[model samples]
Target: MPDTAASKRFTVPIGPQHPALKEPGHFEFTVDGEIVTNAYVRLGYAHRGIEKAAESRNWVQNLYLLERVCGICSHIHGFAYSLAVERLANIEAPPRAQAIRVIVAELERIHSHLLWMGVSAHEAGFDTLFMYSWRDRETIMDVLEGLTGNRVNYSANVLGGVKFDVTPTQADIIRKGLTFLEERTKHYLDVIMHDTMFLQRTRGIGVMTRSQAEVMGALGPTARASNVQRDLRVEAPYAAYKDFPVQMVLDTRGDLEARFEVRINELFESYRLINQILDNLPEGELNVRVPRRIPAGEMIVRLEAPRGEVFYFIKSNGTDKLERLKVRTPTICNMTSVVRLSVGHQLADVPMILAGIDPCFSCNDRTVQIRQADGGAQPNGLSSLMSWEELRQYAIRKYEAR
Candidate 1:
C-alpha cells in the first residue's frame, strides 16, 4: 500500500489581512500538495450595507454616497446612478454636460487601468515596471485634479448635468497629458507583449476561452481579453459616447497576456476619445432644474467600469427617497470566475490569478454575504459556491422574465 498520509490535502487561508490582498477579504484554498483543488471567498468583513443605506438618503444625497462605492471607479457609480434617476424622471442632460461626463469618465478609466497595471506588476515582482507605471499615472491624476478640484472623487457629475466646464487653458493641459500618456501606453504594450519575464508569469495562465468567459458572465477587459466584445460604451453608447464613439478592444488569446493587451489598447482609445471630446467641446448649459421627487418608476443602467460591467437597478416610489436601489458590481460577478480559474493552478499562482481579474473586494462587499446552498452559514459549506452554470441560468431567467 502507498503512504497516503504524505499526499494528504490541506487548506490555506489567505486572509482578511494578508500581504497579497490589501482589502478585507478571507479566502480558503484547498490544495493537494502544490496544486489548488478548490477555492472559496468570504467578503462580509468589508460589508457596509451601502445598498440599504441608499434607501435612507434622498436622490441628490445618494450621488455622493454611491460615489464612495469604489474610489478608483467613483465617477461611474455616480454616472450610472444619475442616469437611472434621470430616466425615471424622463429627462436628459444637456449636450455639453453629457460631453463633459464622458471626458471625466474616460480619464477615470485611464487612471484606473494604470493603477491596476502597477499593482499587478508589483505582484509579479516587477517593481521597476510598477514604479514606472505609477509615476506616469500621476500625470492623469494632475489633470483630474485641475479639472474637478479633486483627484479621487471628482464629483463632476450632478443629477441633471455636469457641475463644471473644461476651459480652453485646461484643455491645453489635458492635450499635453494625453500626448505623454499615448507614448507611455505604447511602451507598456510593447513591454507586456515582448518581455520574456512578464510573459513567463502571465502567458498561458488563467486561460478562459470566449465561451467560458461568456458562460461565466465575465465582463470588462476580462471578457474583452477572451474576445467577448461586450463593451457597453460601444454596444449601448451611454452619455456622450453616441457623439464621440469608442472602438472596442478585443483579444482572442483568452489569457492573462491578452488582458494586459486589451487594457493597454483601451488606454489608446480613451486617449483618442478624450482628445476628440476636448476638440469639439460643446457649448451649452451646465445643468437643468431636476425635480426633487422622482416619478414612480424603475430602470436598469449598465456601464463598463475599469474592472467590468457595473449594473444598477433603481426603483422610485414617487418620493424623494428611493424605494429600492440594487447594485450588482462587477467584482461580485467576477469573483466566482476567479475561484474557478484558481483550480488546478500552482499555489504560488493564486496571487497573480486574483490580481489578473482585478478583484475589488471593497466593491464586492458593498452589501451581503455569500450564502450557503442549505440556507446555513457558509463556514460549514465549503462546496456551496454559486457555480457558473447557476449564475448563467439566473441571468437568463432574469432577462427572460424582464
Candidate 2:
C-alpha cells in the first residue's frame, strides 16, 4: 500500500460504525478531486464464530443457531441447513413439507426485496419512495407472521420437514396480502422506471457491464441486473422448486435502475410461485422421525436465497453433534463488485453503489482472517485469535495509550 500522506490521492474512510452504514464494515475510497480512483472494504466486525459454534451443538440445536444468521433471510438459512442435515441422515422431507418450505422462502423473498427497495431509496435521498415502499412492505411481513406466528426469524424448518403447516384460512390470508402487495409492487416498479429524479440517481451511474459483473463474481439481483444467468433455483432446483419452477429475472443494462427492476420484477415472480404452491398444495405429514445420531457422512447443500445462492457444507461424525459446518453467503461474493464498481464514479454516489449490492455484512462475517492493510495474509490467520487474558490486556494497553 502506498503512503497516503506522501501521495496526492486523498483517502476517505466510511466506518466500522457510521450512521449512513446499515452494518459494520470499513471501506476506504482513494479519491482524486471528488472522483473515486480506487476502493476496498474490510469486514469482520460482526463475526460470531458460527461455524465453530455449530460443532459443539447437536444437529437440532444447530438449526436454531444457523437460522439467526440473517434476520431478513432467516428461513433460507434454516431451509438450507435442514436440507443438508436431512440428506446426511438419509431422510427426505415429505412433499407437503417441501411445498410449505417453498412458500415461506418466497414470502421471505418478497420481504427482502421490499426492505432493500426502501433502503436503496433512502440512500438515494428519495424519502417518499422509501417511506411508501416500507409502508407497503408491512403487508408481506404481516402475511409471514400470520403463517409462521412470527415475522422475522420464522423458525419454519425442522430436520425432516417444517415446524408448521399452512392451513386453508392462513393460505387465504396470504393470498389477500400478496394481492395488495402485488399492486403496490407494480406501482413502485413504475415509479423507479419513469421517475426522472430517481433515474438521475440510478440511471447510467454505477454502470457495470455484464462481463464486469461476471469477472467480479457478483451474485443475486446484483448479477442478474448485468444479465448473468446465475440463479441456483433454476440452474439447480432445490426443495419444491422443481415442481413450481421460477422464472429468472434479467436485465441487459447493468446499472442501479436495472438492479431495481430485476428485484421488483422478482417480487412478482415470488407472488406467482406462492400462489402456485398454495393452489396445488400437497397433503402429507410435515415431518418424519430420524435417529438421535446422524450417520457419518459429508453433505453439501445449495439453495437460491433471496440474495443469491446459499451454500452449506456439513460433516457428520456418527454423533449427535456435527463434525464441521461451513457456510458461504452471497454477500461475500457481491461485495467484491461494489469496491470495483465504485472506481471512476463521483464520491457522492458511493452510498448508492454500496446499497446496490444489498449487502448484509452480519451474514457474511461468520469468520475473521486477519491481514495487513496492504491485503497480505498474516503468518497464521486463525492463530491470531487472542485468548481471554490476552484480549483483556490488549484492550487495556490500547486504552492506556489513548
RMSD (Cα, Å) of model 2: 7.7
Predictions in order: lDDT: 0.89, 0.89
Clashing pairs in 1: none
Report the C-alpha lDDT of model 2 over 1-402, residue by residue, as the tens digit. Answer: 776764887899988884244789999999999999999888988989999989988989999999989889999999999999889888899999999999999999998989999999999999999899989889988888888889899999988999998999999999999899889988998999999999999999888898998899888899999999999989998879999999999999999999999999999999999999999999999999877899999999989888888899999999999999999999999888888989999999999988888888878997333322333345654334455576678679889999
* Residue-level lDDT tens digits of model 1 in 27-80: 899998899998998887777899998998899999999999888889999999
RMSD of 1: 10.9
Model 1 ranges off by over 4 Å: 1-7, 18-21, 367-402
* Candidate 1 lDDT (Cα, 0 to 1): 0.89
